[model samples]
Target: MTDMRVSIAGVKFKNPILVASGTFGFGHEYGKFYDLSELGGICVKGTTLHKRDGNPAPRIAETPSGILNSVGLQNPGVDAFCAEEMPFLKRFDTKIVANISGNTLEEYSELAEKVAAAGVDMIEVNISCPNVKAGGLAFGTSCTSAAAATEAVKNHAGSVPVMVKLSPNVTDITEIARAVEAAGADALSLINTLLGMRIDLKTRRPILKNNTGGLSGPAVLPVAVRMVWQVANAVKLPLLGMGGVASGADAAELMFAGASAVAVGTALFNDPYAPIRVRDELAEYCENAGVARVSELTGGVKPW
Candidate 1:
């Protein structure tokens, strides 16, 4: 039998497949689709210190092989997550990584502190949203902002690990990854949707109500894998690879590319049970290939 377990930041994951934030809304809805205990973890939607109504209607637009979304961080806020969701989440039998996003460093810290109080496995600091005023810009666009935001959260997060999620819109992802590393981030998750747009020829307008949206799906797999490899090489931190992960093969490819663990985002829309399915598939593949541990596949690929 194959050993499918992997450890990141000293925390053990039964498998490396996790559902990315925003794609798997707290796992309560998807729980009806699959057993949450089968997967490694679930990174809940982007939650701010307070609740948000989210963007206007028609926020999701379908592309040729992907989807563009401007959900605008619509969530029940951190407090509700702690009070309403956390109780059930605590009993759900899987690790929960609460994803936090805010407009200021103070907000990020406060959210981290609150989530730390909520008793979760980890905190995923989301600095990629465009709607947020300050923290979003500083944490995602520049090395300064990224490090500052991460450091602020680290200071307040206590024992819970902070995994900074990097935006793919940056020019040199390596610099940003290095900056976060220096900022004391325990791990890194990369390639949050690429900025993209889809226009209607007959209507002469964009498909999404927000005009432009974050593009995610198979169309982004190649680029996402490349960025994961680059950041993995740039930092010693565990890399949570995400982009257009749709299948078990894609999850393995991310591990081969340098992701200690992988996140299934857009693909969840198609298969709500994808997170667990991917894990099972990985174990099967590892057993057939004579691999001892699935984590050994990380960065196992050789360059031509």
Candidate 2:
């Protein structure tokens, strides 16, 4: 089984490194830089039932080691995705997971149904997107709402694997994790960008149009690892950890912390092919560590 791969929610991924949603931009942008098919899969930009204009300009701000953005899930509607992005993306070899957002439970259920019916390889119920309203975090921060949102979508996700993306803005990630698990999430993606902001000292003003935005980049790596580890322990579902993951070292660290897979976020912004390089590094690391498969690294942490 040296060449065997991992399957999450009945969907097979060629590897364990995926490009996180919002960062990859439908996988086509990165395809210009490298062969994304070399990686495991791609979580596309978040889509709603209708197209979104997103927030105003000055949307992104640079922090010390991280960046804050309130792009506001700016994507063509779910129907447009099926007609446009999907046809082009399906031409690629990698699996496609449609990331979806909605303001209410009914909206979420309807969005999931539309995307699932569109034949995406999988669906990530985007309960934690920081850019939108309906208290996006409100649906993800608590066990009650998290479970309810997950359950609502789960009922209609059909055969497509439904992974609930969790917010890092919560008090206890594990509590939310367990709640979604009980709601029938096939897998979990953790640490959707942490809430943060930046100030332009020179301008004496907040940098972003939205006073605060989600922080993502190398600075968020450690927090992502901790949250992934905590949530992985709390739920039996597979976990995809991301946020501030930029290098092979970061990938290995998260895998060691119990991530079944990892998503490359801001790193994609810097190097469009960062995901491929990280995957290559992981393969070499697995070979060097005398490990037959990268999956062996999951939970291989040493007790402190």
Candidate 3:
């Protein structure tokens, strides 16, 4: 059998297919559909220091081949997640990642310390959340803020590796990637949803109540691959590449572009079994291509 194992930072995964945060909802919801242990890992929903009610109604809107969301990091907060959610996910054999975001750097550090103490395998520092302290500018959009956020999480994350998630809405993503890497981030996950909006023709208003949302699904794959390729070459840190990934072929394409691993987000909203399907399909591709190990595909693309 072709080997599908991949190691990110210091955590070893059974495969390279992980469920993107927000879309997987902490694993319990999707566990009802299939064995959660079959995939590489699960990055739970975005959690904050305190509980969030999320944005108003119409938080999610459908587009041609993707969906836009302004869920506003809705969650039961870190305390509840540790006391109530962690035990359930710990039962699975896969790696567990807590995707944490906060309005302030202190909140980010505290949340990282809490989840790290609670024994999550990894912490995904979400700097893409609108910085309330900065009047709504996303932390990931600025090099200084992004590096500061990564340093904050790395400080309190203990033995758990910190993976900084990058926003694609910047002029130069590699600048942010290099900054975070220099700030001691153990890894990076890139191309978080692109900013997008849609209008209702009859009403002449935005479909989402939040006015704009992060777009994901098959539509953003090209952008994701390009960013992954760029960041992968820019920094020595490992990458969890995502955007418009729905199938094993899509996952393979990202790996070829330089993603050490790929996350399935919007696709999971449509197919609960997408993780396994993609995993199987990736293995099939490897076998057909005469590749013995899946890791061989990372940055394997040849320039014309």
Candidate 4:
């Protein structure tokens, strides 16, 4: 039998398929569709130090092959998640990854401490959020800010692994990857979301209330694969690749490109069972490819 298990920074996942944060919520809603334990891991919604009302309405819009969203990290805050959501997620056998975002170094450090102490299997730091102290620039956009954020979280994360999520909006993702790695990040997740926008032709105005949003879907797959490959070459840390993964082939492609694991995002909006389907399909692919283990697919691509 092909070995589907993969470990990211010592945290073992039953498989390489994970549901991206903001798409999977806390896994409670998706639990009714299938057995949550059947998959690998779940990156819970982006939580913050305090509850956020999120951006204005009409925060989502359909594009050609994907959707643009400016949800603004709507969440119940870290305290509520630890007190309420964590218990529900612990019931499942799958790994629980707390995806946290903050506006400052202090907030990230505090969030990391609380969630790690609360017993999360991993902490996925969303540095795509703007850094208030850095003139509103995203921490992931600059090596210095990114490294600082990673260092702050690592200082308080205790033993739980800290995985820094990199933004695609930057010019050089590999540079940011190397910075976070040097700052003590145990693993890395890439291609958070590309900056995009939509407009109504007749109205001569933007479609989303926020004017612009992050684009996610099959549209960003190529970019995601490229960034993953580049970062994999640049850093020694394991990578959790995500962007537009919708099928087992897509997952395999990302793995081949360099992802130690993959996450399903916008696909979940259309099919709640996408993660399970991807896992099963990936297993089938490995079996057909005569592969003994799925981990072998990581960084398996050959350059011509």
lDDT of 2 by residue, 1-304 (tens): 3342566778888998888999888877778878767878899999988899999879998887889999998888989998888888888788888998888889899999988888899899888977777747779878998899898888998888899999998888888888889888999988898888788889888888888899999998999898888877778898887888888789889988888888898987788778988887877777777888777788788857
* Alpha-carbon TM-score of each model against the true structure: 0.97, 0.97, 0.97, 0.97
Candidates 2 and 4, the one with greater TM-score: 4
User: What lDDT would candidate 3 get against the real structure?
Assistant: 0.89
- Candidate 4 total steric clashes: 0
Q: How many Å off is the CA of 281 in candidate 1?
A: 1.7
lDDT rank order: 4, 3, 1, 2
TM-score of 4: 0.97
lDDT of 4 by residue, 173-226 (tens): 899999899999999998788888899999988998888888999999999999
Supply the TM-score for candidate 1. 0.97
What is the RMSD of candidate 3?
1.4
RMSD of each: 1.2, 1.4, 1.4, 1.6
lDDT (tens digit, per residue) of candidate 3 on 32-92: 9998899799999888899988888798889989998888877999999999999999999
Worst 10 residues of 1 by lDDT: 129-138
